[model samples]
Target: MSFVKALIATWHLSILIMFHLSRMRDLKSFYLGYIKRHCQQDFPKQLSYNRFVERQTSVGVYLLLFLNLRCLGPCTGISFIDSTPLRACHIKRAHQHRSLKGWAQTGKSTLGWFYGFKLHLVINDRGEIITFRITHGATDDREPLKSEAFTNKLFGKLVADRGYISQDLFERLFIDDIHMITKRKRNMKNSLMHLHDKVLLRKRALIESVNDQLKNICQIEHTRHRSINNFCSNLLAGLIAYQALEKKPSLDLEHVVSTLKRA
Candidate 1:
């Protein structure tokens, strides 16, 4: 069973590499060869790299699952959303000129600040990612909500931070029957958040942890792609790689069962 799992897992990684390195034939060939050497199975020799990526096949199905799978039992009708900065490198490279130069910018983060794009992720109560959108640093967190990437998500209540709260956004989501749950900003006068909302808002922290896992564990945003095409290639590859690593929803079965019981 372990061997079967490993084979299945490695195949998915191979697909991701194909996607990311597609633009750089040399890198793609080299990395695929590296995988073949490590696996001792000549995985790359089994198929044309371009054809394999185009087919998508099982890998494409899994991407769908990542965005639309239902929890094993019942959904809490809750979702969490957040965004993280993806810097190509230090700010020193800002004016050096690159393909993605106009597509990213310096943005404020909890770590002080950084220059680059932001990857927005939306996850469910069970911690399964439902949707993702990459945006310019100057793009507002709420802007992606208008994107088809997120507007089409199959969810109910969305939990986010103050950056995502706006009267227009709330109204827009409400039209889709998805309620927006976020902390009230100091400058705005609105109805007080319910005690339950406050409690659920705390769970929003899970998305941040997920961001950390993507960067530190999956190395998604740690690339130095010199061109915008390469940057997008790496970003999509990272998403694919993370999906491959995600065996089940982030929650343990015990916790999932407990949440279901409470719901």
Candidate 2:
């Protein structure tokens, strides 16, 4: 296929994947039962399931990343950051899994230990994603904040869970003019927090709701991926799908703004 034709094919396949994910349909069934009949006019030529998968996987991560970025909602200065595990396979099959052999790792969360990657995400109080990064499960939550590239456009207060509470990380973000607010660990010293900050911290559950929507509504987590490329493609598609939702969890920004102003 010509370069332009290949690009179009990739884009069309991505749309199909997003459609599949958003509707929670079986991938193969969606392709055969719906896309082949209803979407035939869009394709230059018909493609078999295996060929379609091959072409879609070749579309590269950069394209999907671009699409994800394009769908991002505006930053509201108030942002929430969190990470969730993306398990590659059943723990029983971890030793036999080779598709993500070098890419995935074992990591522990509040729920427990799992073997896979971790998706670090930042979303505005509007419940729209600002940016995201994926890392090995073993990677520290505070590590991403160290990169200027990641925190470049992020400003105002960034809220996260206690896993992100580190004195060094807090100082680094403070130097960059981005205030880091996180819940204190039980053993840590009790420093006074602003009333505004404390209220926003109470609403950190908004991000958790976002995570639940991504996993359950958008189907970001699945063990049926056959290749790392497919795994990433599915994930990016799910993120894009979530972006298309008409309603999302959001904070009462008007109240937050007024409260901060009064204080």
Candidate 3:
């Protein structure tokens, strides 16, 4: 029956999420040694690890829906934006890497060249994810911002690092009533900013911290992916897992704002 199939799909999705949250890093060992040997009651009927992986692509839609409908937080006007590199493999291994060969590309970050994709994120002052996009490693950081739908829910001040400095992008977001704030490059000329804007810029590290949790805690990035589809499935499950976390990196905007005014 369709209902039975749906239930199985949900069960499979849960297991994938558990793998990301679990201390075990290897999905095979987690599914076989942990779930199969110990959690039989939790998953009464289970497929072999190979079969489950082959069909995990089925739950991809549900993962996206849950993240959009449940995990994502409301845009709170004040936001921080940044991008982090997701290296599929070391640059030295790019030539021989085949699993993500076509999907992932060689891209360079401040940390140096990496062979992978870029995850662009926008988070609010309370450190909740507002919007996110994944692009090939070579994609421009400013490309996603050009999409109206990508930033439709956002407004007010958006803080970013020096890498996001672009006049055209700034004017584009300005037209949408979303002001983009970034640290002025040493050679560039921009007028003095307001006290509130300057104070918020100091908190740009909040986005970087969020990125850290996504990689280190959620375990979104790893070099062990064998299939491109599973690679995506793992990523979505990781983001969903992050939403379940009780505490996330955040800012004390009220106190900071009041203190800035007093100064």
Candidate 4:
């Protein structure tokens, strides 16, 4: 009846959350098949798919705030850090891509060259996400760690792969009371490390498991984004949905939780 009518902000967030959590692969199909068919009673005044696309930017800020305030987990002394590539398009199609042309870049990973951005994720031993940073695809894995605000909440021991190993980086974090432990590179000399650190370094795959769940289960990365705002909304919504997962990959830290708490 009225052109000015709009869905409530919470309703908008709920719909975005369902987009990533639902079985449907894309937002159009999910909105048309599921929400339009089964959710009309709950959202009778919802906008059409096209209009919803236009409204994504409105919720982008809200999604980020919700992530920082509600979805994120706390930093346990023992945490893991890792980076994953979020490809905007195949490397071959980089020249033709338009949606994220300037935003994305040509970067190299352990896998190879990809055209997109990088997601640096940090998680605690319990498989809970502590914080994250997104950067240009070419950004070094160690760059985010250089920021004080990024590592402020973290403490005690931080286990990471060799990619994060740098003498200066280690000393900087150590100055802030964050003891970073990583295996020395092939060219580096050996140094004495506690048995606990060695064991946790081997278990660094905990972050990998979280990465798998985020991309495969939570729909964290999709290549079909039509706009940068839409892409951000999708990623944030996926993280919110992930927070609802009952079971997450974790370590047997029951006995050590109290110990770390006191230390």
Question: Among these predicted structures, which one has the highest TM-score?
Answer: 3
* Sequence-dependent TM-score of model 3: 0.96
Q: Quote the lDDT for 77 in model 3.
A: 88
Model 1 clash pairs? none
Cα lDDT tens digits for candidate 3, 1-263: 99999999999999989987885777899999999999889899989999988888889898988898989988898999999999999999999999987899999999999999999999998889899999999998888999987999899999988888888899989999999998888788768888888888888899889999999888999998878887888899998888788899998978787979798
- The alpha-carbon lDDT assigned to residue 218 of candidate 4 equals 86
**Which segments of candidate 3 are over 4 A away from where they belong?**
none
Using all chains and alpha carbons, the TM-scores for the candidates as numbered come to 0.70, 0.91, 0.96, 0.93
Better of 1 and 3 by TM-score: 3
Candidate with maximal lDDT: 3
Clashes of 3: 0
For model 3, which pairs clash? none
Location of the lowest summed lDDT over 10 successive residues in candidate 1: 66-75
lDDT scores for all predictions? 0.65, 0.82, 0.90, 0.87
How many steric overlaps are in each model, in order?
0, 0, 0, 0
Clashes by residue pair, model 2: none
55-159, model 2: which lDDT tens digit per residue?
667665655756655787767789999999999987678889888898889888888888999999999988998888889999998888888878887999899
- lDDT (0-100) at residue 81 of candidate 1? 81
When 2 and 3 are scored with lDDT, the better candidate is 3
